[model samples]
Target: MPAPRIKICGVTQAATLHACIAARADYVGFNFCPPSPRFLSLPAARDLGAQANGRITRVGLFVDADPATIAEAVEAAGLDAIQLHGSEAPQTVAALKARHGLPVWKVISVSGAADLAPAARYAQAADLVLLDAKTPKGALAGGLGLKFDWTLLAAWRPSGPWGLAGGLNPANVAEAVRVTGAPLVDTASGVETAPGVKDMDLIAAFCQAARS
Candidate 1:
């Protein structure tokens, strides 16, 4: 089998970005959600993205942000893709992609088989889909450091590429891939020493484990 694609999200620091690139991560995600501890200012995200060059993909993560905000971040950060981690309607996804001309990744929180139904709607509008663990109501949208049943994704197949996320770490990533057979995986709090602090060693180990 091919190596599993690794996307390290919630990156704020230049060193952490460097760590991810050095680790051969397939994608690096920058949080634009102000509520997230890993959030980055537009200027900071732009600087970090410049550092990435063409070595890895730069993804901008947002939650129910307006078009103006999304446009500003995408221009300022030079993002290659936008990750929508909210209750954005399919129309919103279509508008964002059409207006910005950037690929869109729609994240749907799945807790059960019923949750998978939403992917079909998103797949029609999004360039990719991210199946993540649902955060409880009145909580932060993502990066809550939680995990759901991997079996929930065993039978999931999307029209476009998809990724598995939530509560994935170096220790369990191999098993997570084994169970889901996901071609791509994303990590945020799982690789952090704290809410916003990334552990370089953990990042490297995660990439290695996911590939091995």
Candidate 2:
């Protein structure tokens, strides 16, 4: 199998973004969730977006945000795509895709085989379905560095494009690919030194390890 594509999420600093580019990460995500420690202000995102304009693919991350909010951010950040980590329905995903004319990724919080059922419904609505760990009650939706049973994905076949996230770090990412056959791998807290602080070395190590 080919090496999985790497996406470094929750990028908050210019240095960190540059590090991802230097490491040849396939995508870079900017968090827009207000509760997230790695949240990016529109102004900051605009600058970062301009900096990364043609050098890399920029994805804006949102959690149940309104259409207007997503629209404004897309313009400010010049995002190539938007990732929704919310309770949005398939119609909502499809509507956003039609409204924005960009790829829309729906995040499915998974704990068991049943959780994978939603992927089929979202296949036509979303450009990609991202399977991530389910957070605790009233907790942050994602980026908590929690992982579910990878074997749960073994028997599951995706209806469309998909990716793996949650608790993936440099140490386990390669094995994650081996088991899940995830064509794309994403990391947020996995490469961080703190809640929102991304370590350059860790980013490099993660990219190398994922492709190793």
Best by TM-score: 2
**All candidates' lDDT scores?**
0.91, 0.95
lDDT tens digits, residue span 1-212, model 2: 99998999999899999999999999999999999998999999999999999989999999999999999999999999999999999999989999999999999999989999988999989999999999998999999999999999989989999999999999999999999999999999999989999999999999999999
Over 4 Å off in model 1, which ranges? Answer: none
Model 2 whole-model lDDT (C-alpha atoms)? 0.95
Looking at candidate 2, the ten consecutive residues that score lowest on lDDT are 111-120
- The residue-by-residue lDDT of candidate 1 on 124-164, one tens digit each, is 89998999999999888788889899987767777778889
> TM-scores of the models, in the given order?
0.97, 0.99
Pull out the clashing pairs in model 2: none
